[model samples]
Target: MDLNLRKAIKSNVSGNSADQLEATIVDAIQSGEEKMLPGLGVLFELYWQNASEADKDEVLNALEQAVK
Candidate 1:
């Protein structure tokens, strides 16, 4: 089967409001289901693509702290 996960995730969440998006993310994380990872990754990819260097640095710093 040919499946495009990023395209599928984008199509599902496109046009969502900020609160709705947040809810979706929270639900996905709280579910702790492996199936939701691709969706989260797509969301992160979207954020990374649009983020400024400063924003990227901030996220990286947060991730570094999170891993510690």
Candidate 2:
């Protein structure tokens, strides 16, 4: 069984608008299920790839603060 999780996740949210994406993210986080992590990760990867350096730094700072 070959599962390309990133591809799958991307396909699932491909056409979503910003509000729709936010809803999806919020729903997944509220669910608190381990299975949702990969999808979140793929979403983060997409964001990271498109983010500017300043934006990336902001995200990293937020994540660092979140874990502190």
Q: Please name the candidate that would achieve the greatest lDDT relative to the true structure.
A: 1
lDDT tens digits by residue: candidate 1, 1-68: 99988999999999999999999999999999999999999999999999999999999999999999
lDDT of each: 0.97, 0.95
Tens digit of lDDT per residue, candidate 2, span 1-68?
Answer: 99888899999999999999999999999999999999999999999999999999999999999999
What does candidate 1 score on TM?
0.96
lDDT of 1: 0.97
